[model samples]
Target: MRDLYQRLRITPEAEAAEIAAAIERCQHTALKADAATVLQAEWRRAEYDALHDTLSDIGRLRARLGLTHAPYWRAGPADDFSLPPGPPGSRFEEWMQRLNRAARAHNRWRRLRLGWWLATLWLATLAGGVALGHFVLP
Candidate 1:
């Protein structure tokens, strides 16, 4: 059995060259091992374990905060999740702004819809009253 870092063939604080080499090594090793099996390896170092647990804690924190996805998990062509390149909280604030704007727009639309229904009912009642008065009186 191999630790998580061992399964991934990466070391803590690995240099770029080491990371590249380790990635290649892991790909080769991954061929013979199932992902589940590889990930089941016991921790070889306490520090790696702590780092993994910290990531897990962040996942829990995101869930507790009602976030659907973690902002730091960039899955782009040029992925850089190790450390965020942009200013901290900028991406989160952007996402929050987007959500708030959408919510505000939806609320406006909902109010408009409710207003339309109320106006239609009022017009229908007024027309009914006028028709009744015309039929009943001179």
Candidate 2:
């Protein structure tokens, strides 16, 4: 028999339609009552976690785009209202400014670390290839 978690995995995005289908499948299947109960609990937990994760992503995007305040709901405006640019070096600016001085410093550190590891691997492979060639040549 398929595990309850496997059944729960069928439901994606916690959509009502998908979840409903999963619940129906679970109810019709002749699975052990304990396993089914455990799985139903996990399904709700996963749904809650998925919702929290989505909300966090939305909040991050809003922060990155400098939408700290909600837009005013105008009944009928004569002109279009566009938001102005945010302050320099703020959250939005930090998210926008690629390769900034601070970011450059961190990137340089990362490159150095990667380069060191890559050089070590390259030397090891070169040594191994030379040893094999020497043994196989003669």
Candidate 3:
């Protein structure tokens, strides 16, 4: 009869409560009360089940609970969504490369600054020694 997925704005994988809420949420807009009858009316539910037997467990539960269905199923398995390791130039690798570049640049700058200060101090000492020898030695 009616495509429950479209009528309820849910996937076949949706739980009983999810389907009920979807139908309820769309009642005024896209959902027709007749469409939700499958969840409420036993005859309508049988018709829906007979028409679509391949529904997932959640779908069957939705049919049994009718429109009054509240979410009975527990949350599905938790997913970490973590990706496997990648090759070079990937996100992690790129971040590491940037960090290394910053460290190297900072070290080079420190060495250059230290060398400049040491050279300046050496020149001042040599000039002082020369002045002392020229004036005091004579």
Candidate 4:
């Protein structure tokens, strides 16, 4: 996948006007056309951004793991590696769903834990105030 942001010499956070300006100033016709096609529309741009981020993360992970050749598998003899020729099927979708569920569950747990801590702090403050009032007034 091409990094449109890098191609256009702009940051990922560039605004629509900035992208349009970059497209206008771009000298390469092919790069200009590609950038205009992908970055002009909101939906396409969003999908591109998501895919780009995912690919970039995968690349970083591969580099970190010293497996720059293949993904999710160790780098071995060239003949030992073979990728599926077709698009991912139901199993991929199911795995993504499971991951999403796990993320949501973890977020919910974090919020609940924060709420408990705040409640405990509030109770402690209230108890301290009551005790201070009882002793100081008498």
The number of the candidate with the highest TM-score is 4
**Pairs of colliding residues, candidate 3:** 39-66
Q: For model 1, state the Cα shift of residue 137 in Å.
A: 1.7
For model 2, residues 60-80, the per-residue Cα lDDT tens digits are 665556765435532212111
Candidates 1 and 3: which is better by lDDT?
A: 3
Task: Give the Å error, residue 136, model 2.
Answer: 3.4
Model 1 ranges off by over 4 Å: 1-3, 6-86
Using TM-score as the yardstick, the better of models 2 and 4 is 4
lDDT of 4 by residue, 15-125 (tens): 999999999999989878988999999999999999778776665554443343445443432312222322444445556689999999999999999999999999999
lDDT-wise, the better of 2 and 4 is 4
Give all TM-scores, in the order shown: 0.42, 0.28, 0.38, 0.47
lDDT of each: 0.56, 0.56, 0.60, 0.75
Off by over 4 Å in 4: 67-138
lDDT score, residue 5, model 2? 35
lDDT of 1 by residue, 17-115 (tens): 564555556645553254234333444334445766676566555544444435554453122113333344555667878999999999999999999
lDDT of model 3 at position 86: 48
| lDDT score at residue 16, model 2, on the 0-100 scale | 53
**Top-lDDT structure, candidate number:** 4
Pitting candidate 1 against candidate 4, the one with the higher TM-score is: 4
